[model samples]
Target: MKGVSLAPGDYIHFKSQVPLHKIPIGTKQWRYYDFGPKVVSPLICLPGIAGTADIYYKQIMSLSMKGYRVISVDIPQVWNHQEWIQSFEKFLDVINVHHIHLYGTSLGGFLAQLFAQHRPRRVKSLILSNAFLETRSFAAAMPWAPIVGWSPSFLLKRYVLTGIRDGPHEPFIADSVDFVVSQVETLSRDDLASRLTLTVDTATVEPLLLSDSFITIMDTNNYSAIPQQLKDQLSERYPGARRAYLKTGGDFPFLSRPDEVNLHLQLHLRQVGVEARPDLVQSIPKGGTGGSPSKESDKKKDPDDQPKDNGGNPESTSEESQLPPSSEIHSLDDQLLSDARICSMGHEDAIILMQSQYTVVNRILQSACELFIFSLLPIYVESSYVTSNNVWKFRQLM
Candidate 1:
């Protein structure tokens, strides 16, 4: 077959614009797209079954332009979650990422949750789209799973295409479906079998115990692949998670409704303190020029009328100058230190109290330091100081 040519509006075009890179993971070579600045924490996007990292080209382009470092990968042919997690960890290490904000769709979402469960501290936030905790009615179809492995590539591609042909008729969605079908055609039988095994093998794991991480679950109300019961269960599992529902986008909301999906995504990212650049944001039309508010009251006011640094009252600036300087404001740090001093008998006592807290913090930090320390003597010395020494002795030394 000749190469498929994608239109400029197609997501595949964006995917092609970004160069792909290969990273060696043991005996296998994994293909990935790593774009955006290196300084920011990466937004690692994992695509659903039948999706390569290229499926999220829209997200990569949109988010990366907004100052985020986005990375997406082709799932290495690993059947079990443990192997997938281990290989992914090694891949992150090779790329020098200690922590990341994870975004995944469908099967990829399952993997993302597993990865987060395995390394909760390493995940900054999680975005799950059209994903479920386990296989539902799909497992019943697994009796024919062996057939998928033995079927000709053309037949497999046709089955996948036929299944998703009922999705929204948007040009981008159609393009994406074709692109995904093409990707499926290139997959080896072993790869297809492993992916199928992954789906069936997936089961309900314990709810993540992540208090510090932000979790967003995005799905379309019309999604049929994952039942409503599963979605409710997911919500019950993550009570604190934010949920965004589109009225209609079927199984692949990201492709069918990129504008809405992007809006929800940007809002979620902003809530966690990551925002797109002003220039990049302004470049995209509000609501993608598709829908508009019908009421005159819904119209946005002129930019000039918006509140400025002076709080929309120029005279307030002069009044503000009469107020006390910010430096004079009493802060929690100052109050805490004052309390520490008051609780002590003298300067020595205050110093000792502060030093004790520092020592405790230092001891806690040694765990992270152990990552780099190779020598046995250094480890023994640090361990001995932490375990054998009394608090009184440490205070006296301080």
Candidate 2:
């Protein structure tokens, strides 16, 4: 149970690939996961009240693999906003990162903005999701904010967990909530107390000197822990800020909707002049083309295994003439056909296509020619694990 993951094996894999770094700057302990290349500018991820550095594992895994530097850090123990900001600044100094792109959620978002406002030159861009412009409502709700430091750990956890809605949720959202609960279980009495104190500290972010173009306000269209009015107010405040809106990702979109969130983050980084060093990405050998898959599906057939076409027009099956099935498609063969237009049903189902002795993963509905767009798409997977993190991958039929 200790090594179990709510969302498959992401946690285990994350720990294996990225080492945890705990550096003490004065009395504050800086815990974080710094991944990807060190040369490029870093993107610092800060989480909300119930979050830790590990909460942004999805971001670290995806971006870091693509040669982007991502530092997902825990907010150092601090009583007030100034201390938090100063401690973060010193932590960055200790890390030797001169400038950064900040990504924050909830209370972390406020701290990101505050830091940006105070140290304008040090922050290149900001991406705030489900964050607040002010904590007035929270302070008002918890009249005993001053006593939070003295509150029991269980009480503090309850206060934090109550904010995360409990009940039936979509599969991904439910998994995300479960994962956050697991993270909360790891927090110490001081951790929860410090975050709760920040939440109810009644501080507001001042007008930032950074341009709106360098800011991206990401949030779900569906309900979240943050108030509607607060989100609206933040939007209104930054009229020129890039608005990356998702359909329904709840409170923790980074965990629930990592694909969309990572996509937005990449776009933000590109817009802010932080380029990804794709050359630094390492190649892992997977079965099929040049190697063997870790676990070959019983129904899978490699190009070498298939009979050669006489005319070389690529053999068209009967299923290729029609749209693929609408039900739950488990295998790649059952999911794909010769005609890409027919194979792509646009239901957001994963499809695998084997061609030219290589495997291609087709994730999104994409275009009529799935393989053609594979190179054009930024998040496209060239070749990946046949089964990664206990999740099936997508490959476009070339």
Best by lDDT: 2
lDDT of 2 by residue, 167-282 (tens): 88998798788888888888999999998888888878888899999999999998899999999889988999999999999999998888788889988999988876655444
Query: How high is each candidate's TM-score?
Result: 0.63, 0.70
For model 1, state the Cα shift of residue 175 in Å.
3.5
What is candidate 1's lDDT per residue for 151-237, written digit by digit as tens?
A: 665655555555564634556455555556666766776666667667766365567766533999888775446667777777777
For model 2, give the 10-residue run with minimal summed lDDT: 285-294
In Å, residue 342's CA in model 1 sits off its true spot by 64
Candidate 1 accuracy as lDDT: 0.61
